[model samples]
Target: MVPKAFEAGYPKTLGFRKVVKATIYVKKKEGMSDEDFIDYYNTKHAQRAAPILQRHGIISYSLTYHLERDRKMIQDIMHGKAQLMDYDAICTFVFPDYLALAKFLYDKDGAALSSDHDNFMDDKLMKMMVGDEYLLIEDGNKVG
Candidate 1:
């Protein structure tokens, strides 16, 4: 998650815009380890997603491996912060507009990318959380 201060400043500097955040938790089924999932994301899934993202209007995105504390935070958010099995990874994206995002979602390339991701990872037991925030910007510059 972005620091609260940074989140707060986003509206002021970048102006008002919409932010879409997605948190994906890949839970191992008994024998699977967190490292295995990370490797799959870094080595296999990321390679496939990169091209699709570029083809779309994705301005930027990041993939992060959660540390122990971060994992705790995820658990906390999901279940009042109680300790739970660590999450596998976190992915975030910043886009220009909802139409662009929608286009990416419904496009053939996007479906292919999603299919590739499903093929590379074990998402049957995965948990995903998504949220959106709209901030009023000072000027139109931020929208662009």
Candidate 2:
């Protein structure tokens, strides 16, 4: 079942654990300041979400904010090399599998975690991509 140009026993045999990763592209609430958005998401939302996610065996989770000034400088130096994205931040949540992800998202008694989204995130602009992590490199070494 090898794809074109791929060697036999490639990805799965590379010794890396396969995990489901959700990449959430988030936008700040309309008229919300960047500082406030970052602060609330880190100190408020993430704090509240961690316990629920951990209970469901979430492997890892992180948030990365946009660096507009740095990106602009890099783009200027390289003559607009970096494409700009309108997202305020990118959130990554890694789970052991789909079942864990489902539970984390739905098994809760109340929508405490998701309801918190309104505090800082723009619902209309948020997007999520869920898929298996295809690790090609780790610790500067090739794994696949």
Q: Model 1, 52-125: lDDT tens per residue? A: 77776677768876655676677778886565555556676665555555666787867776665554455676
Per-residue lDDT tens digits of candidate 2, residues 65-108? 87566567879988987777888799999877777777788966
- Candidate 1 Cα outliers beyond 4 Å, as residue runs: 1-17, 28-30, 67-86, 118-120, 133-144
**Alpha-carbon shift of residue 32 in model 2 (angstroms):** 1.5
Q: State which candidate has the highest lDDT.
A: 2
Give per-model TM-scores: 0.56, 0.81
For model 1, the local distance difference test gives: 0.60
Pairs of residues at least 3 apart in sequence or in different chains that clash in candidate 1: 15-137, 16-137, 76-81
